[model samples]
Target: MYKKSLVFLFLVFTVCHGDIFEECEDVESESFVSSWQSCQSYVYCDGDESMLGECDEGQYFDPETSSCDDAANVKCFLDEVDEPSVEEEPEPEPTPPVMEQPTDVEIVNTAPVVKPNCPNSDDPSQVIFMANNASCADYYLCYHGHAIEMHCTNQLHFNGLTGQCDYPENVHCPLDEPSAHKCLPHITDFFPHPDKCSYFYYCIKGFLTLQQCPFYYGWDIERRSCVQLNVAKCYGNSRRA
Candidate 1:
């Protein structure tokens, strides 16, 4: 029985070796032997479960697909890794022109110059002195609140003695009586006279003397003087009448 069992075991082993060689023979290359199973020595699951089959040189087997795809190929794509390109913005345009502002120094305020009341006073535009008795015809003009001196060109007669520039009222003498030719003594009229101006000049009824008188007095024609209160002479002539 020992001898018969030994012979049967040897025959079974030889048949198994022959089957493995025939099955793996279809894999032509000598390097294809690795595709065969070690224990049974047969084609591994018909190339599907082979240990080494159709494997990439540098890649390992991928169990999910049962293939040898690249390790780097599984990573994100180049397009995904790179960020999207940003658009460039356009520049703004310039604004229109504007007018310049005016300066404060350009504007000026001025007061009108005062004028004389007389129609044809030496200078019609020249201003005259102001007094309490100033009339519309002989309106008084002021300069810095003070009365200004004026020529007697507007008066018909002048009283030298009393320094009045208006006509005398109800004189005792006749109109034809020639009066003394005289001028007023007021410092504002006589002392400070113009160097070349005519102090006396002929007028309508008598002569006009460049002089001044106080508001209360009038000219005394017969005496050639100004009278205070229209009655008495306030100033005397150089020559006694």
Candidate 2:
């Protein structure tokens, strides 16, 4: 009788911890759960909108009107928008504002006249004459109704009907003439005598004319240094005899 009792206890313990309890048992072919637990281990649900035509769960299988919005984690069902049978509203026309005429001011008509004041004689109070040996013969006639100073140094070819020197062709200066010209502006009262004009530079010294101080190594007045002019290498260097 004791042996029978021991066999009964062993059989009961084995039955309690059976292999069938530990194994996963599928509730349906599509979903499954552990046989040992009441709650399902995994559940297969229909796809939402994003994965159209796909069989994967949480993805949209229907493409017709559904869109899977993972951000909202919901399937967006769009309604088919039928074409409207009625005409749409016409856009409003913009209105132009009425402007009022201004009062009290009379617009005066004036003619544009080009007065060829002698070249370099801009101030009305001052009297200026053409340099005795001015390279251009006719003096500077305002071309294009604007005054620009040009010189004729070489020959008749250098002097055009405009009374201005033509820029030399096929020649290049070490530094450009424009940049050099910018260094000096308004050479007022620069009255070097005809004989000295070729060889000397005149500077206006507080309304009195004075010769440019010889600058062998440095700029005068400013005490800034510069190199001696190589007359042979550079044209326009002073032919100071």
Candidate 3:
């Protein structure tokens, strides 16, 4: 009996801390856990509609939903700090509240908008939620009307001018070291593919792999991360290396 208890503890530790994760049909899978994510995780927020997805190289999270239209889109903005270019986002349509919520998590709309701001300049008055912010790495929300400063996974910062998090070339951040983003959500494992937006990733047993839908197809959230959505008519030859 004591030996069985030890094995159970080990399994719990691995599931909670191990980097392994597999794709599932829904949040009901045995692997489902709140806030779980993989080693390389990225996310986008559409007015509380925060979901994990990939972004283009060098580009930071932009509130411009158009910029984040699909996984395959690319972006790379370079600008200075202090001169923020956070654009105002239009009011989004009312949708169901987010599935995951902590007791202390502050509501964006209810929170006062008077940000000093997140690593990336959010709507100067509102919180701009990104999967990866340079400071307040995780579980940070409005601190007295000011969006909490986000930190890079390990080494990064939000450039006010470019409106993204990246290396410190001209941006007003440390110029010596660099960092990467890590999994923050309870459900940490799979996310959109970083390089090939058409693809998403699956992490299991400390291993990660990129996955994509069948030919000329795209990911349909209502369906499967990998499915034949047949949106190729809108985008010719939707295949990329």
Best by lDDT: 3
Candidate 3: segments with Cα more than 4 A from true spot? 1-187, 191-196, 214-241
By TM-score: ranked, best first: 3, 2, 1
Estimate the TM-score of every prediction. Answer: 0.14, 0.18, 0.22
Predicted candidate 3 versus true structure: per-residue lDDT over 139-204, tens digit per residue: 234433333334444334445444445554555432112222133443345544443435656656
Model 2, position 160: C-alpha lDDT score: 31
lDDT of 2 at 148: 40
Query: TM-score of the candidate numbered 3?
Result: 0.22
Overall lDDT per candidate, in order of appearance? 0.31, 0.27, 0.35
lDDT of 2 by residue, 1-241 (tens): 0112222222212122222322223233322221111111112222221110112223221222222222233322321223223332555643433433557645434322223354532333332333212232223333222344333444221323222334445223222243332214444423322332222234443344434323222121111112232221122332322
Q: For every candidate structure, what is the RMSD over all alpha carbons to the true structure, in angstroms?
A: 59.5, 38.2, 22.4
Q: Report how far residue 132 has shifted in candidate 1, in Å.
A: 5.8
Give me the overall lDDT of model 3: 0.35
Q: Tell me the spans in candidate 2 whose CA falls farther than 4 Å from its real position.
A: 1-144, 153-188, 193-212, 217-241
Best by TM-score: 3
Error of 1 at 203 (Å): 30
lDDT of candidate 1?
A: 0.31
Q: Against the correct fold, how does model 2 do in TM-score? A: 0.18
